[model samples]
Target: MKYPLLLRFLQYIATLASGVGKRKKLFILIYHRVLDAPDYMRPQEVDIESFDWQMALLSKYFNVLTLEDGLQRLQNDSLPARAVCITFDDGYADNFTNALPILQRYKLNATFFIASGFLDGGRMWNDTIIEAVRNMQDSILDLSELGLGKFDVSDKSSKNQSVREVIQKIKHLPFDQRKNYVEYIASVSQNLPEDLMMTSEQVKKLDQSGMTIGGHTVNHPILSSIDLNMAESEVLENKKHLEQLINKNVKFFAYPNGKPEIDYRENHAQIVKQNGYLGAVSTQWGVASKVSDPWQLPRFIPWDKVPHKFMLRMCRLYCA
Candidate 1:
């Protein structure tokens, strides 16, 4: 659940105090899309103005590095008292056109993890629904008539919980099953462009901008739901795919729907390390410490509206 305003405000106050103890961890921030599109129907949770402000604030106290550089600093014991790295998942086009300029302006670099399937014909299941919900020209979809069974998409309010519930329903099936289902729904709901992803050309732009690309599965799936053989294949195939496409050895990963106890498991970590990834990240909200599993590195999502209070909460994490 997203945190309440006041409580999160207090949390931001805590981020300022992140300088406690011997200071032995790295903070990784994970992002998806940047908010700047004109369509409210396609709401990106992280906006550009908010991102600008947050990075400005972060720069004052932390040395923002790319994910690879962060790992290297940790390995060499040369990270600053408070260090932070920026990473993005899914090779969204915005990461190329909207995001790279900002990071370049700040002289900070980031790592972008890609879902190979979507590079040509892939979209995360949730995003397919989101794009469709945005372009409903009729402003209403009679989902009951569509016979979605128990799941209802008729209520088209743009509220967070409403959209989340629908996503959960869509993601309920096994990985392949759910993605195919979402694609079917999207095709009927609103016919979108064939590619909502960064093309090979776009990825090259990011690489030129000093952004490293990491492997994030061939198709972004909840890895834990599939069989062990499928899971290993998923990881290895994505690494090989990205290595060939980007012409660089992909050494890092951020699990899709990355939660340590839920979306990923110990076995996933073993394969990642054995397959030659230097580190992998999870959506766990604490800072990354030496004791922190490199294969299970932690990251926090920066919301679209990052007020000063939110900054305080982030500061507290460092302090805590």
Candidate 2:
């Protein structure tokens, strides 16, 4: 079926299934980077063409709102059918260079959650792993010295796998330990990209362009892997830096590696709230409604490439 027909059919199905007085559902779409072209090491990220079409579909079929507006209406029960809020996590420069123009073309708004520590030439640890593996001259990356296992980077496929394995191995480690591993990988790799993240000026430009900016911690640490006090500092400090940079109150938060209970806990949510954020989002896969906690709002991304299936999947999430 064509996209328009499928969307209409799905809308009718949703209306009939939801019946009367069903609480409004808010679908928060999460993104990391909108790449200029496909990167084998980060295949899941949407490229320029893919992101263009996705935003086109969103503008056409859904009532796309800013995060602040969406949550406020979700509370007041005033949301239109098929309401959604687009959000991007981490402060990638492509978000400004690649994602912003598409968003503007569609006249849509999105929230960007930034890891403040990575702004202005600082790369995230995972990106360190990805870039290191991507540019490695050796066919094999033997990390047995670091006890993270050896891997074959003989080709694109192996390099991709090695990147994933190495990141997973160190992702949840203590912050200092993870830093050491990432540094070791960086030292061994050649020609790593230094300009992966947005500069502070680009962040302010995003705000000037009328997009919302939210906090994603200072260092993008896994909150569960760090002490509570450190976690609190991460949350608060990020908000502080962003507000200072943008000259606007950063009203929302997205947990770094935003998994409930594992990456973050209830106390982390409390910290976000107490720090004066209006709300926060998690990496949970579902739709949010009135009964959902504002501090732990759920987020999802539909990975379907086909238009109809993608819209269908979105409808299913609403009814789920």
Candidate 3:
């Protein structure tokens, strides 16, 4: 069936199902970048057109709330039906240049989790691999010396696959080792975009515009890969930096690569609480309710391109 017709039908069903139970569910939608146009290397990230319609649908159907307000309401058991909070991770510059206007157009607000270490001109390690592979002069990327396999980068498909494989291979390496490999990759890749991440001013602008600014970390490190002191430093230092940048008390955090017990662990949750964050989010998929842990709240993103399928998946998340 066509999306328009199916969407209307699902909307009716969603409205009825949303109010059927006393359980107040909070669905947090996670995003990284809303691109100006489709990016072949980052096909999973939504472009402006897709983001626009998605935001429009949320504005029309769901009671979207700020992360702070949503969490508070969940604790009070006063959440409205189909509660959702929008969130963006990694502080991409496109978020300010592209996503914010659409969000404002829909009269919605979102939380942006910034990695302070990569603000201004610093690029994330993963981005280095992606850009390097994208701009590679040679068809074959030889990483055999690093024990990472060589990859074909002659075409878009091969380049995309190479980028993913390289990142996955080195993502969990010890901080210094990861840094070394990323640096090596950067040296070989030419003309990487320097403006990929948000500047400190852009982050400040997001806060001033009534959006929440949350800490991601200083270096965007995997907390579990580092020592406890380093982990605490990464979390506390990031919170301190963001608070200083916007001159607002940072209230929430999203773990870097937020996989529980893998990217971060229980102690890291304590670190966030100890450093004064009200809550934190993980990449885990679920709907948050009163019984949910504020520190390790789950988040999900519906990737369905069809509007009706997207709406149905969100409703199913609540039911799940």
Candidate 4:
């Protein structure tokens, strides 16, 4: 049936019946900034209320575990039914101000991967592009010289679309060139807003909140596009920076723009391991199995509105 309720009901029944004695899979859910209000330029980020609801559902239906615990379970082939781990990438300030309280309320442990270059009032290249596009004076943006076609930013919908398009284009560029383009645009786009990344103190507070702090590569580069030496430095330096800030051993890493083969490569994973990380996560959509690669553990962003469907997706992942 096409009805969400019916699909969810069927999924629940199938999960209970089929997954009764099966080896359960690990589902790692990933999120970015959790905001009080949606930033028009970055609508992909979940709001505080939505995140709260998702976390509530996660804690209820899933055996929510720490990243370390989850990995160990995977190694031992002893994951619980509906085993799930919560993670966030790109250390945004709202993650501390908004998401941390909800996680505390639920008594759930999460892993937050910080892009160290963006800490202490540094902005990500993507955010710079977003702000530049949002604050541009012209009704239509013409970047023909840069090979990007003109975009209409006169209305809200058009503006958001333009922001997304520009981000998509820049995401594929080499890290340094992407930075150069974003900076060039920001200089021309008038006064850009203040950086939205978490400060060093805020990041330390996140670690203090009983959450695991992980490295997310300095400047959040697409690892595959950059040279191996620079990629290795990004991963290693990010871990060291977080450890210095938190005064503890940071064990996990998350690849920036983390797709399996596109944003990162096998060599990048080796670099993460050589730098002394237990594991790393990628933005791949699937549940982790006993045989899954620790360095490229898959994670997905759940955007469904219905709690039942959300729970159903986790159930299906276990079944899968």
Worst 10 residues of 3 by lDDT: 13-22
- Give every collision pair in model 4: none
Model 2 alpha-carbon drift over 4 Å, by segment: 1-23
Q: Which candidate is the best by TM-score?
A: 3
Evaluated against the true structure, the overall lDDT of model 1 is: 0.74
Candidate 1 runs further than 4 Å off: 1-21, 37-44, 137-161, 304-307
**Which lDDT tens digits does candidate 3 get at residues 113-230?**
9999999998998998899889998999988888887899999999998899889999999999999999888888889989999999999998888899999999999999999999
TM-score of each: 0.85, 0.94, 0.97, 0.93
What order do candidates take by lDDT, descending?
Answer: 3, 2, 4, 1
Scored by Cα lDDT, where does model 2 land? 0.89
Among residues 3 or more apart in sequence or in different chains, the pairs in candidate 2 whose N, CA or C atoms overlap within 3 Å are none
What is the C-alpha local distance difference test score of candidate 4? 0.84
C-alpha lDDT of residue 251 in model 3:
96
lDDT of 1 by residue, 1-320 (tens): 13587546544454445536357578898888776743354455566776776666666556777787788878777777678888899888778877888887777888999988888556667777776665555534444543454333344454333456667765646887776667666765656656668888888778877788898998787888888799899999999988887788888988888988688799999989999999999888888877777889989876636456556656667767
List clash counts for every candidate, in order: 17, 0, 0, 0
Better of 1 and 4 by TM-score: 4
Ranking by TM-score: 3, 2, 4, 1
